[model samples]
Target: MANYFRDYADLCFEAFGDRVKHWITFSDPRAHAQAWHSYNSTWRGKQRGLVGISLNCDWGEPMDISSPKDIEAAERYLQFCLGWFANPIYAGDYPQVMKDRIGKKSAEQGLDMSRLPVFSLQEKSYIKGTSDFLGLGHFTTRYITERNYPSRQGPSYHNDRDLVELVDPNWPDLGSTWPQSVPWGFRRLLHFAQTQYGNPPIYVTENGASQKLHCTQLCDEWRIQYLKGYINEMLKEPLLSHMQMVTEIVVPTVCTLCILISAVLLMLLLQSQS
Candidate 1:
């Protein structure tokens, strides 16, 4: 599978390298690092511009910030989500917590080895520092708590983490199936990325709230508020001064949705001053 993807990427780069300046080998390479690793080692030198990957995560906060278990669970959730991908790009391997827990659980389940694939030292070296910039797509937040799910049910992604996710009822709902407008999560997510990836140049590849389908309303006040709240959090003091940040709002193609453009511009102006 990795070889196939590498071949395809080579073709694209050779065919359109002149026109396409930036090339992303994969959107999220957590589950499949081999392909991106191959690109980094083989095709990266050939490309004229930057090569990177985009990662999507909702920031996880501990249910009990003071409790060690809860804090571990929250960190575990991050290791499972963003760290699952970012660690390889930055640290050149999976998070240590993931390896320890998964390895232990796999042994108890009568498995000889962990389900999570291990990278060779050479491969790890290739993957590390592969990304020129980190692309982040963030929305919503979840309260995480320690929950020891039994591995007897079978080895699965959710059970492996042993955590429970909850959402605050007070958070504003934007009529989506999931994802409430929790602006603080945006700041926390950015901070986590900065700390974990050594403050790599970050681009907010996707950030916005989803509205109900088939709603022909032109005045998307909910979206505007969501954008304002989240962008304002990003522009807060200490954080803004510390990291180089760029936000790109993912807007829908509806012709009547002119309010989104105006709201984004206004927020950008506000962000600049802060």
Candidate 2:
């Protein structure tokens, strides 16, 4: 799979390297790393382009911040989500919690080895430091608490994590399908990425809220509020403002997958619609 992406990337670079200054691929961590290696070794000397990977994860806030078990469950949630990929790119292996938990579960399943794939020492070195910049897509937050899911329940992703996710009943309910609007999660997630990955150059590729379709369709004051809330939390992050990075927020075509152009632009959008 990695080889296929590398070859395809080489073809694209050879064909349009002059025009494409930035490239982002949606692939597994290892495949993404291999694609970077190909870029560096084969064409980076002349291609004049940067390659990055897009990783999307929501912040997992502890249900009770004071409880050690809840805090641990929150961290475990991230390890299973963002750390599932980011750990390899930054730390050169899966999260330690992942290895231990999965290993223990595998043992219970009577498997000789962990269900999670193991990276050899050599493979680890190859994948480390592969990303030029981190493209993170985050929206909303979940309240997490510890759950000791029985290994006898059988092997599964959710069961492996051993945690339950709950949303504050008081938070805004976009709908049964949409994530609840909890802006504070944005700040915590950014801080986690900064501390965990030595603050890689982060691009907020996707961040926004959803709105129900209505007849007027012009005045989505609520969506504006959601954007303002998330963007407010985003600016509060010291690392984000520390760098001269572009903070663009584009509204998603699908509403579920969207972002911000800026508050000014959003106001203009609202004005135009009105």
Pick out the ten consecutive residues of candidate 2 with the lowest summed lDDT. 244-253
Off by over 4 Å in 1: 30-47, 148-152, 213-216, 237-274
- Tell me how far the alpha carbon of residue 95 in candidate 2 is from the true structure, in angstroms, after superposition: 0.5
Local distance difference test, each candidate: 0.80, 0.83
TM-score of each: 0.79, 0.82
Kindly list the per-residue Cα lDDT of model 2 for residues 14-101, writing each as its tens digit.
Answer: 8888888787777345478777888888878887678888889999999998999999999999999999998898999999999999
Candidate 1 residue lDDT tens string, 56-131? 8999999998989999999999999988888988999999999988888889789989988898999888778777
The candidate maximizing TM-score is 2
| Pairs clashing within candidate 2 | 249-259, 249-260, 249-261, 250-260
